[model samples]
Target: MVRHWWLILIACWSFSLSADEVTDLYESRIEVATQSRDDRQDALREAFSSVLIKVSGQRDVLERPEVSRQLSQATNYLVQYSYVTERQQLYLRAQFDEQRIEELLRRANASYWSARRPNIIFWIAQETQRGARLIGRDADSEIVPAMRRQAHQRGLPISFPLLDLTDLSNLSASDVWGRFERPVQEASRRYPSDGLVMVRVQEGDNGQGYLAQWTLIVGNTRRSGQVDTEDLNGIGMAVVDSVTDRVAAEYAVSYSETEASEFTIRIINLQDLESVLLVESLLRRLASVEQATLARYHQGTAEFRLQLIGDMRRALQALELDNRMQRVEDPWSVTASPVLEYRWLR
Candidate 1:
């Protein structure tokens, strides 16, 4: 089993948050709705495709030669599944073997994307029968739910602006539609995302398909792409998938980084046993952290020596969840030794 499986079990059993509740997409599982088991094989392929897209951050991963071959034998990789009926519809929750899939990806020479993805602040412009409008956080509009569903499916952490007076004072739909990142990012200060995706959607030249233009902005950088879809439901998903492929290309690491390395990190301001246990569990449960041992605890601090696998970026990304550990930013007061800045959020 991959180390992520163990982390999933521990998060489910010990943490207050469920595995699904975490923004980090750790589980290699996906649920598909079907009318009957007759669609099981197709569902198997779709589920595998979905999880693969989420893990590899490649929208075209299914088209890879080896991946395409495996899709024909998708059922062979299924670890287990359960059937549930909801609202007169049957849903299959399937779990695939992550280790096997990682091996397959390795054989294909594809790197594995870390779960610590950047939050994307989506600025979407929609042209409706009435007029064009921006999709805000609380617009009570039709497109918001559709786009959100797509975000959930792709396992992309996406958010929309509140479009309040503060935002209105700075930007308009025209700014978003124009693909202007300077003024847009200036307005997006409160949203604190690693990047921004600006989408402009209108009727196509044929007046049937959706004509869309998009750009992704990250730290003075921009990547642009377009998608023409007959349906509105998949438009946002298509844009997100394209930009994420680029982001993954930049950040993904090798899956073979499972060799354990000894590492020691210090935690400051731990007040009690609960804090110590919580701190240790946070590190030990990370997929990148093979195991963690408390070497000693003294003077409101704890020192842990850990056996680590996976990339350092991944370990840092796991620590970002729930503000468990934060990097020391101040240059002067920081210790010469590596210290993880943490505080109980009570």
Candidate 2:
């Protein structure tokens, strides 16, 4: 009879301890999840207007529709608390403002329009019997240089070669047709270019300057547009900009230009044998420097070398100035170990 009484007392003590632990857990949960009055009111407004809080994990705790509605309504006023299992911590935060979020979405849409690539090629026309004058013009006159410059400014990639119309100047109309056709047909080639721009310069209405007409042809399907101007520089720049904007819009890429300043360096220790290789290596590494080459290497008791390049400012910044060797004044000291001097390439 005494043993039975002892067993009953032990069981009652165990029950009381378990009940206390459960109550403590419930109180802690309530304390962590409760929110402020203002936050709850804001959350309620959002909840009433068709917005819903999406909680993925542990959603069974608030499964009832009424519970969810109440939670959403009080979310703004109620402190939002999240328990991160990995971190083992609770985060209390406020809800996002709908007005601010809507503005962000609108700006994102605008960015889509600005981030487009252009797909047009441009050419310039000059008077010539067989169009030899066109061929005589430099490669820089072709769409490649102007387009590359524009693309660089707009922060676009050069996806393909910029073809020059000068190459077609020597050909007859039939030759021109065949030249364009053979390569185009041989491999079933798709002209990586989206459109071709032809700029024709003729005597102006005033006869003082040239009258420029810009024509754009969109592939073989042939959708064309034209613009005319009296100032060649203005017309050229305007046509390129307009065509770039249109093509960029079509391709969906943003355009912007970064202007790179020129830097010059002179090397005073290059021999004829080492000149080519050394200059080539230097040029390859210093891409930001517009041009770099061995200008002259004189041999006596000591050797003297000269190198001219662009972008000295960046070079100094990159090299930290302290490590690079110094310039030589005495021609005699040059003969002993070969002196190198750096100068800006004009």
On TM-score, the candidate that comes out on top is: 1
User: What TM-score, over all chains together, does every model reach?
Assistant: 0.70, 0.30
lDDT, residue 274, model 1: 64
> Alpha carbon lDDT of residue 98, candidate 1?
74
Superposition error at 73 for model 1 (Å): 4.0
What clash count goes with each model?
Answer: 0, 47
- When summed lDDT is taken over every stretch of 10 residues in candidate 2, the lowest stretch is 19-28
Candidate 1 lDDT over residue span 221-281, tens digit each:
5788898878676665567667677666554555545555676777777887667767777
Candidate 2 residue 11 Cα shift, in angstroms, is: 57
lDDT of 2 at 145: 55
- State in Å the error of residue 319, model 1: 3.1
- After TM-score superposition, the amount by which residue 144's alpha carbon in candidate 1 deviates from its true location, in angstroms, is 3.3
